[model samples]
Target: MKACNERRVCVTGATGYIGSWLVRSLLQQGYHVHATARDPGKAQRMLSTIEGIDRLQIFRADLNEDRSFDEALKGCVGLFHVAALMEFGTSVQENDHVRRNILEPAVWGTRNLLQSCMRSGTVKRVVFTSSISTITAKDEKGDWKPVVDESSVTPASLVWKTKNPGWVYVLSKLVTEEEAFKFAKENGIDLVSIIPPTVAGSFLTPTVPSSLQVLLSPVTGDPKLYPVLVSVHSRLGSIALVHIEDICRAHIFLFETSRAAGRYLCSAGSCTLPQIMDIVSLELPNWISKSSKVEFNRSAPSIISSKRLLDLGYRFKYDAKDVIKESIQSSIGNGFLNSQVEFKV
Candidate 1:
C-alpha cells in the first residue's frame, strides 16, 4: 500500500528451488531480504553463495504453525509465498494422509501466512507461486478447450474422483490459491498468483526438483515416473512447460507491476514427448543415441496462454530448447546423469 525505497521483502520456502533463486535475484537487485525456511541450516547452505548474502536474513518458519511467520513478516513490504507440498509421483494411498499431509498444510498454511501478512502492516503486495495443474483446460463434457488462460481452473470435484496423489497435490494448489485470493480480497491485500507449467532449468536446491524429475524422466528412463507424465498429459492435453528463471522473474514482475491482478498463466509453451526428445537431441547431440526412439506424435497443441503477463510487459528469458539444455547441463553438474552415457526413454 505504501512505497518505500528500502526494498525490504520476505520470501517463504527460501530453501526451495524457486525460493533460493528468488532470494539471489532480489539480493542482486539490492533488496534487504528476510528468508524463511523449515531448516535455516539448509537455507544457509543453499543461499551462502548469493551476491548480497549479508543483506539476507534466514528465519525458521512453518506454514502449519500459527504466528510462526509474524517475526519474519515484520518490516517487510512484500512476501513471496513459494512453499507447498508437492507429490508428483507418489503412492501414498490414504485419504487422511492426503488431507493431513498435503491438503491442510497448503490451504491452512496459506491462511496462517496471510494472517501474519495482515498483522505486519507493512507488507503491501503478496506474490504466490502456483502450479499449472490449476488449469485443466477442459469443458463440461470433459473435452479439451481450444485455448486455456487465467480464467481456466480445475474443479475440486474432478480432482476428488481421480484418487491420485498427483491430483491431490493439484487440489492442494488449486484450493490454496483460491483461499489466498479470497483472503487477500476480503482484507484488502494486493495479491498476485503466477501459475507455471512443468518448471525446468537449473536449480539451487541440493536435490533435483520434483517437477524437474518428471520433466527429465525421458532421459532418466525411470519407469516409475511414466504414469506421472501420462497423468500430466491426460490432464492438460500436453506437457505444458515454463523455464524456472522465467517463472521466478514473473513472480517478481507481478509483485512490482501495480496493475497485475488475479491469476497469470506463465508458460513458455507445450510440447509432446517426441518434441522434447528432439529438442534434447538437438541441444546435446551426443546425449541421445541414434537408437533412442519415441513414437508419440510430434505436434502438440498450445492449450495455455500468457497474454496477461505479456501485456504487462514481462518477457520470458528462456525458450523450450534453452530450458531443456540448461536442465540437462544442471543434471550433469549435479551428478544426477552421466554425460558420457547415452540416454533413452
Candidate 2:
C-alpha cells in the first residue's frame, strides 16, 4: 500500500529551504535518505542539522554537472529533485544557468536518475517539486475570490523578465516539468509533479525568501510595479496563498500513494495584500514598513483553487493570514529578520 519505511531515498538540494525540510520529513517517516548538494561543505551543515538521524546520509551533487548525481542515485529507491537557481537576483539564476542549473537537472537529471533507477531496479517513483507557475497563467491580474487550486485564470510572469533575473527560472521549470512528463511517459517511470502558488511559511534555513515576497511585493510597496502592483496593494490580500509545509506534505502524499501520478495543485486559501499585511504586522511590526499602504491589483489572478488536492482529503495547517503571521514570526525568531539582515524589498 505504501513504500517501506526503510526505503532508501535520494533527495537533491537537501541543504536548501524546501530540500532541507523534505529531508527531515523523509527521515521522520523512516526513510533512509541519501541527501545531496552542490558543495560538500554544505553537506557538513546538513550533517549537523540532520545529526542523530539513524537513516540519514549526505553527499555532494551539483545540478549543473553531468555526472553529478551518479553516486547519489546509485542505490536509492526514490529521488526528490529540488535544486533550482531562482533568478530572484543571482547572476546565475537565469541566462545559461536556467539550462545548466534548472533545465538540465530537472529534465536531464530526471533522465539520468531514471536510467540509474532502471539500473538499480530498486527505485520506485520520482515526485517532482513544481510550482503553480507551470499551469500557464494568462498575464492578467485580478483577485480570485474563494481562491485556491490550479485553474486557467492563473496569472503568469517570469522573475527574470521584470526583475534583474527575469523569468528564466519560471521558464526552466515549465520546460523541465514538460520534459519530465514526456520522459516519464517514454520510460514508463512513475513521475508525479506537485504545483503550489505563492508559497508562504518559513524556510527551515535562511538561504531563500518566501515565495510570498515575489508574489506579495508585486502588489504591495513594489516600486518596480509602481502603478500596477503597488497601486493595488489595497486589494492584494485577496490572492491565493499556501503554506510551504503543506506543499511539502503534498509531495509526500504522492510519494507514498500509487494513484498520485500526474499533477496536483497545492494551496490553502486566498487573501488580499492589505489583509496579508494585517496578518504580518501583528507579529512582525518591526520588519514590515508600516508607512506603506496596502493596495489590490485588479490585474492579478482572480482565484487559485487547490480544491483538487483538498478533494483528495489533504488538509492545510495555515490559511492566508495565519501562514503569513507564522512565517514572519518564525523568520524573526530564526534571526533572518534581525536589523542586521539587509534586504531592500
Candidate 3:
C-alpha cells in the first residue's frame, strides 16, 4: 500500500470536528498538511486538539467565499473537502442562510476548488467527507426514501432539505456528493465519498460534533440531526455506530488503498437507543431519566456493510457501546462533562 507520507494535503474545515481529526491523522502519517478555516485566528483553536503541532499550517478559506481556497490548495497533493454548514433551528430570517451555507459552498466553492486543483496539477486525488445522507430522496409520487447506499436516494427538494432541522446536514452532504461526482465526471477528478454511520469514539482530538450529544444523541428536534436518525423510544432496532478514530482511520485507509473508490461505508455496529442508554446507564445513570422514553422510531431496517473495510484489513478499537461509553468518559475526563450525568433532555 502507498502511504501518503510526504504528501502535501489540503483539508477544508480543517478546524472542525472531522476535519481536525483528519488533519492530525495526516500529520501523524508524515503528510505536510495545509488546513483551511474561515478565520486563521480561529484556526488556532484547533491547535489544542491536534497531536502534531509541527506538521500543520493554517490558512484561511471559507465556503461562502470564492478566491481563498486557491492558495491553500496550491501545493497540496490531495484534497479533503470536509467543510459544510450544519446549523439547525427554524427561523425565517436564516432559512436561506442554511441553504446557501451548504449549497453555495458545496456547489459553487467545490467546483472552483476542483478547477484550481487541475490547474495547479498538484492534486492527484480528492477524498470528500461525504455522508450516507446523500442516499435520501423523494419518490415521483412524493413519498419519502431515507435509505442510503450504492443506490439512488433523492434528497428532499434543496430548500426543504435544509430546513428539516433534524437532517438538514444531509442536504448539504447530498449536494456535496452530487457536485463532487458531477465535477469529477466532467473534469476527470478521482473522488471518493466516505459514508460513515453514527460515528462515536475516543476523541484523540477535540472536535465539536464528536461530543456527548452525538453519544447521547436522540437530540431535541434540531436541524443538525439527520432525519434517518429520528427514532427514539420504541422497540428493537439499531443505528450503525463507528468510533471517531475508526472514522478517521477510514479516511486515511481510503486515501492509501488504491482499490478504495466510489462510496465506502464506515461502520462499527448498530444499537437501539435504550441499548445505548443501558450501556451508559452503568456509567452515568443520572443523565438519562428512568422515566425517559427510549423507543426506536426511525432506525434503519438494515445494517450497513463494512465488509469492504474489513476486507481491506481495517480494525475498530471500540464497538458501539464501548465507543459511546468511552466518548462520555473522555468528555468527562476532558472536563467537558462531570462524572455524573445530569442530562435532562
For candidate 3, give the lDDT.
0.65
Tell me the tens digit of each residue's lDDT in model 2 across 251-339. 78878777675778776766665565566555544444523443454344556666667777788877776677766666556654553
Cα lDDT for residue 207, candidate 3: 37
| Candidate 3's TM-score | 0.81
**Tens-digit lDDT track of model 3 for 36-147:** 8887787777565667777788998776566668778776768888876655433444557856654665688778777767776677788888764554334455443444
Error of 2 at 66 (Å): 2.8
Please give the TM-score that candidate 2 achieves against the real structure: 0.77
How good is model 1 by TM-score? Answer: 0.92
RMSD of each: 2.8, 5.3, 4.8
| Candidate 1 regions with alpha-carbon error over 4 angstroms | 1-5, 283-295, 339-345
Error of 3 at 301 (Å): 3.2
For each candidate, the alpha-carbon lDDT, in order, equals 0.83, 0.62, 0.65
2 against 3, candidate with superior lDDT:
3
Clashing pairs in 1: none
**Deviation from native of the Cα of residue 160 in model 2, angstroms:** 9.9
